[model samples]
Target: MAGTPSNEPNEAPSSGADSAISNEKNRILVSDLMGDEREVFLLFNGSEYRLRVTNNNKLILTK
Candidate 1:
């Protein structure tokens, strides 16, 4: 059990390209991703999601 891989939906694999990008707590500025824009789209597992920054500076994500 100790060495068994997790079946948890939230568990991220610890290898390969995803691992390289996910191993650390990478810090990315919102300005870098959403420069001059209030919203951006994210593609994950073939689905699209929208991320928006509200006037009050709150973030919202919708599918």
Candidate 2:
């Protein structure tokens, strides 16, 4: 089968269309998550964490 599709788990996407679809659905802008704020709090599994934008414009996450 010279032109058959692959069902292999390790196969890369055949075209930009496949990658673009996944990128759009799974990606989020950092600006949207931290709008007009330098810090945001996140909670997971009954624990709290802090996400901060440093003065140097780098991100820091801490528990």
Candidate 3:
């Protein structure tokens, strides 16, 4: 049987939040995420997704 996912709302870390208290293993810098390129490919569940840093310095993820 499939398990029910949590219904809690996702929230961003507060300005005063402690980094140590958060999950560091899953954290990555934007530069690292882009990896010397404006666009990067992300693979999830056998599907491909594109992550891009827009010219305006915004992020966009597309399938």
Q: Which numbered prediction scores highest in TM-score against the true structure?
A: 2
lDDT of 1 by residue, 1-63 (tens): 777778765555567777776755576888999999999999999999999999999999999
Give me the overall lDDT of model 1. Answer: 0.86
* Local accuracy of candidate 2 as per-residue lDDT tens digits, 5-61: 778555455687877787689777879999999999999999999999999999999
lDDT (Cα, tens digit) per residue for candidate 3, span 1-55: 3365677665576655575557576689988777789999999999999999889
Query: If scored against the real structure, what TM-score would every candidate get?
Result: 0.58, 0.65, 0.61
RMSD of 1: 6.7
lDDT ranking, high to low: 2, 1, 3
What is the number of residue pairs that collide in model 1? Answer: 0
Cα error, residue 22 of model 1, in Å, equals: 8.7
Work out how many backbone clashes candidate 2 has.
Answer: 0
The TM-score between candidate 1 and the true structure equals 0.58
In TM-score terms, candidate 3 sits at 0.61
Stretches of candidate 2 above 4 Å error?
A: 1-16
